[model samples]
Target: MTPTAPDRLVLVGGTIHDPATGRDGVIDDIWIEGGSIVARPTDPSSFRQIDCRGLVVMPGGVDLHSHVVGPKVGFGRRVAPHLARSPGKPAAVPTIHATGAAYAALGYTTVFDAAIATSAAALAHLELADLPILDKGIYLLAADDVAVLNALDRGDACETERLVSDAVRAGRGWAVKVANPGGAVFWRKGRGDHHDLDAAIPGHDLTPRRLLERLADAVQAIRLPHPLHVHTANLGLPGNWRTLLETMRSLDGRRAHLAHVQFHSYSGGDLDEGSFGSGVAPLVEFFNAHDSLTLDVGQILFGETVAMTGDSAAAEHLAHTTGVPWVSHDLHLSGGCGVLPIAYKEKSLIHAWQWAIGLEWFLCATDPWRVALTTDHPNGAHFTAYPHLMALLGDAAFRRAAFDRIHPAVRKRSPLKDLDREYSLQELCIVTRAAPARIAGLPQKGHLGPTADADLTLYRPDRDLARMFSVPAKVFKRGVLVAEDGHVRATPTGGTLAAS
Candidate 1:
């Protein structure tokens, strides 16, 4: 169904918190006309007005990374049937319709599925089309194609750029993603564990390091709105922060995005318990010094969630260690993904450490604009977990109480105990809405400026930050009321946003 805008709408007397536009809690009136924020109409009676006194307004939320659809998500839904039906449990993998309604009700208006294989672009789009009330797109797994890898191997940089461009255009992709680059070659050869950023592919001379650098260059050369989206090698392993640092250094100041960075920043070596701690300090230092890099902290909130990714090796390692029922599929030579259910326990040592690491990155990062908030959705926790995570970040006492509940050893070793920085409303706005949209290259999103998309959320201000964000008073998508008070009111069809 086509999404039609209301004739005219006015949100009067709300404190607007559009950080991108530098309007920090300014009590103002917003005018909407023909699906876009516009100047106030000459005749005040021409617009239908909504009373927003004492309300806080901002642009609709934008989630930069999530696993919302496609074959891997389907696999997760199939494997975890109980998640969808359990009385007290939120589904680990929700149905397409539920994903749309959940995000809309949460006041989000834009989302990007972080990894979609180039070969399955059509299937992913079909699933995304059913996702209503938000503009959506996918990052193509362009580096998984052997032809593209071969181009990199032969030093045919120009041809490689062409292949990357052609794939993005053909797939209608928003960005290029390299998930554990060259790890597939290792996986197929039964040595997936041996491959690192510097390790060579089985039959090709191309290394994951070079794969990252070259792909990043191609993405910049294409001048796409977003840079290359990278899920670097050595995710979820002990002492993998070095790999992350190396991945960063290889770019040599070229722009790239590191996905699920929390998983990569661990201090331990050789999977040992004593060594497992927060590696975020050094990583955060490197991150702070580099302006060309951006990341989404795939925070791990303690609960049951599905871990799915194009990085089959990481999944394989996780499945082996946790002894969970896991699923993997190789799409010929294109690439593959893995899915498994994981439950993080507060008393468990590693889980506690992981929880601390994620928060450490969030608190330590100097710039909110460069680090967006994500639970990696269903991977770290559910997208619904955002409210709870926000509460943890915005309320220092809440974070301390939760930290004290975790494993005792984690309290002694982790850096979270010493951190007291609490995020302000403006900084929270930057991380959740403004930063993500800007990182995803959606210019018209994440702000309520004139001529921007009229996707806005209005909230009744409360001292509880989580409550303030969780149940918005009203949500408008493209100038149409889509949700109110934590319920989806309109199931309007959403359009696909792609880069050509």
Candidate 2:
């Protein structure tokens, strides 16, 4: 359905929070015309007006990482059947309608499914098409294709370049994501536990090192808006830090983004053989130096969350450990994915440590600009935890309250408890709106400014975290009222932007 603009637009008496435009939130009126935001009209006539009194308005939310559709999502729905049917759960993890409605209700205006196999792009698009109230797109899975990997292995970079471009065009994807690079294909051919970057992937001549380097260079060469979205090797294993470092070193001069770093951060002592938190210090230093690098914390919220990823082995490991009903599938013609239900318990030592590590990343990282807020969407935890995370960053007391609830191990050396650094509105704006928009390569989002899409959120200013996020006073999508006082006033079909 085509979107038709309504005549006359004025958002009156609202505390507008558009960080992209550097509006540190002044009470003002926003005007929109032809689906684009405009400066206030000198003449009051020739416009439809929206009463935004006592509401906070900003650009729509943009999700940088999520598995919203395709074979993997189907597998998730099947594997975690109870997750979809569980009462009181948010829509992001359930049926298509629930995902769309849930996100919109929370004021998310734009989101991207971080990984989708090119062979199954059409199905992914169809799923995104059914999602409501947010512009969405998928990053194509490019690393597993034999022809492309083979070409790169031979140092024929241009041929590899062409295949990547062709895949993007064919898949109509926003960017390319190389997940575990050649490991997926190798795993299918019966190579077990290729956890390091230097390990030989069963069928491919290219090591994960060569695969990452070539893909990073090709993504740089193509000059897409977003870099190669990489899910590194050694995910969910002990002593995988060395692998993560090598993966980063492989793309030293090039541009790239790492997905779910917390899952990749583990210590050698407890869980597995000598495989603990090896890579973070260098990884952090490298990221601080490289302006091109961006990452989402993938902070594990530790609840009845679902762990889903395009990496089949990692997901299978999780499923095996938990003994839950797990689902997995290979794109056959392309890559593969797996999903399992996860719970983060206060009494569980490992889960407590996982939670601690995420906060440590938040406190330890030098610049907030390089990082964005993400629960890795049901992987580490649920997306609904964002408000609590926001509160953790905002109110010191709230952070303490949450910290006290966790296991004692988390309270010991974890920085979350003793730290009293409260995030000012400016910092909150940076993490949620400003930084995310820049990372996702969408200039129009994450801010309120002239010519921007008039997607906004109005909140009843309060110290309550969940209340602030879940029940905004008013929510707008493209200058139209979509939610009012926690009730959906209208349903809008949001567009998913793809680069074909």
lDDT of every model, 2 decimals:
0.88, 0.75
Lowest-lDDT window of 10 residues in candidate 2?
270-279
Error of 2 at 220 (Å): 1.7
Provide the global lDDT of candidate 2 against the true structure: 0.75
Return the lDDT, model 2, position 248: 73
RMSD, one per candidate, in order: 1.5, 2.5
lDDT against true structure, model 1: 0.88
Residue-by-residue lDDT tens digits, candidate 1, 1-500: 45455769999999989998889999999999988999887898989889998999989999999999778999999887877877865688998998988898888999999988898898999899899888999999888898899998887889999999999889888998888888877887888455358778889888888888888888898898999998988889888888888888897589989898999998788754579887888889989999999999999999888899898888989999999899887645387688898999999999999999999999999999998999999899999889889999999998999999999999998889999999988888899899999998988999998889999988888878888888898999989989999888888887798997
Mark the regions of model 2 whose C-alpha exceeds 4 Å error after superposition: 1-4, 269-282
Residue-level lDDT of model 2, residues 203-280, one tens digit each, is 556788888888888888887778888889868777665667677777887778888887777767444453333235
Over 4 Å off, model 1 = 1-4, 192-195, 270-273, 331-333
Clash totals in order: 0, 12
